[model samples]
Target: MDPQNYPSMDQYNYSNNGGNNNNSGYRNQAPQQHQQQQPQQGGGYPPQYNQGYQPQQQQQQYNPNQQYSPEQQGIGMQQRGGSGNEFLISSISSNPLAQVGFSYGQSLFNDGKQYVDSNIGKYFSFSSLKSYFNVNTSYVFNKIKLIIFPFPQKTWKRRIYRVGDVDSYLPPRDDINAPDLYIPLMAFVTYYLLYGFQLGMGREFSPDKLGTAISKGIVGWLIEIGIFRLGSFFSNSYSIPIYDMIAYSGYKYVLMVITIISSILTGGYISFFVKIYLVACLGVFILKTLRVVMVSDNSANSHHDMHQQHEGSAMRNYFVFGVAMLQCVILFFFN
Candidate 1:
């Protein structure tokens, strides 16, 4: 082998060292190239980290002048409005005046409900009175005819029904002889309207006048109720229900309405003779209707002593006559 062609020991060691240095340089350059390529791939960060960080930058740099669609604006407005409403409700709940008003209204409602349930509810059994309004068209037509001419109805006694060993009168729907408040209330309203109409025809109609007429009619009705109650008390007769008495007394209003209607049709004024004839019809109706209430049943009278029954019967007849006579005065006043 030739030593000069290969190299001396010193030169050989230098060449070996240069070779190791060049290999290390290539290894170091490989890592530097990978680090440089990282920036081009994903901005020198992990993909997930970049993804998270970009959203934050976008939020911070968001445009304030961006316009939204109507639906989006509405949704945003509703959210704000809902918050505002909550704030307003809180403010109202804390206000003393609002609290006071609420409490006052609640108290008034409770008091009114209690008053109606206590005083008025006791006398008026609304459940039972519902039957009065159960009348059909035929019943109403026949009832009007009977009221105008009651002398033809031979049967004045109200139908009796037995229920669990107790006897109860049939409702007006089932029996024509039964008393009802529906006709009376309707007739009373009709009379008022007729009266108002008459006044208008005469060029004397006024709200105050109409109000006064209604008040007078109501007062008259109450007076009749008082008379009937007193008579029942004094005569020691078989007392009917107070509502029945109200119904009986209210029948006069039907006649009064008819009379006023006749007057309006004839000459727009009630004549004295026409008033007298109506009074006679109303008196006869009242007398016949009250016979069922004022007179004691034989079965009921059997419970009383002879003297007591006889005395009661005599007083009842007197009271009934007096009540019938009162119709003339009431009819005349209405006219």
Candidate 2:
């Protein structure tokens, strides 16, 4: 190698130190130069870099104590605009199939409501029947006692409400003597359950037999209603409401439930005699209660004239007796 091609060691070190000093000087001056050019560039960035850049002057100017108006908030929300969810909802609402489905569902609901209002609504007023369910535990206990042994109660007449020329019978909640559907409904349900339980105890439980039992119960109930309606018609007492008749007819289920329970507890041995006694009690109860309803005037009348013209007529008594005696047939049929 030629000696002149490479420098001496001391000269090489001096050249390297000079290059390092230049690089260090340039690095030290860069920040100062950048600081000096910031005001000219308007935001510490070059003109080319700041083509669309904006400083967050609003954030810098914000004051925590400032109160914003609803108008300002609404404007901000408008600027933010609708999200993906809003767009999807709008799309669905604009769809022809979705619109058609919505219209069809609304029409179906309306048609069903109209049909129900036109058909069964006229015959049954649920609002009036709400009073029948207002019974409490105490009322239920007393009612059960009355059903079992109604002879102790001397007053079978329902309490009358006379306020501002409006005459009506007090609800069962207010008057113990008043007819209610609650006990009857509960007893009816309990009778079926007890009958099923009795079948279960005997290992003879079947859904078919249970259904048969329910059918029999319903038939018996309908028959009783028919008997009452016919008896009222024949006896010349047609002032009673059909709802009242229904409540009255339903009460026999209470005695039926008792008979079933007695049968269950006694293993079907003493049940026959117990059923006879309960049937008799139920018959007496029906006789007395129906007699009062048959005689009392449902329309406007003074206390003296509350009794109808045929209060103690033979036909009325005979009808009442016949209704009472028919309960035995129904009870045995249930068994």
List TM-scores for all candidates, in order. 0.65, 0.65
Question: CA lDDT, every prediction?
Answer: 0.81, 0.80
List ranges where model 1 is wrong by over 4 Å: 1-40, 44-127, 268-273, 296-298
Mind giving the per-residue lDDT tens digits that candidate 2 earns over 162-193? Answer: 99998877878788888788888888898899
How well does candidate 1 score on lDDT at residue 260? 81
Q: What is the C-alpha local distance difference test score of candidate 1? A: 0.81
Q: Quick one: best lDDT, which candidate?
A: 1
Residues 175-253, candidate 1: write the lDDT tens digits: 8888788899999998899899999999999999999989988997898988888888888754577788888788878
Error (Å) of candidate 2 at residue 127 is 3.8
Task: Please provide the root mean square deviation of candidate 2 (C-alpha atoms, Å).
Answer: 10.4
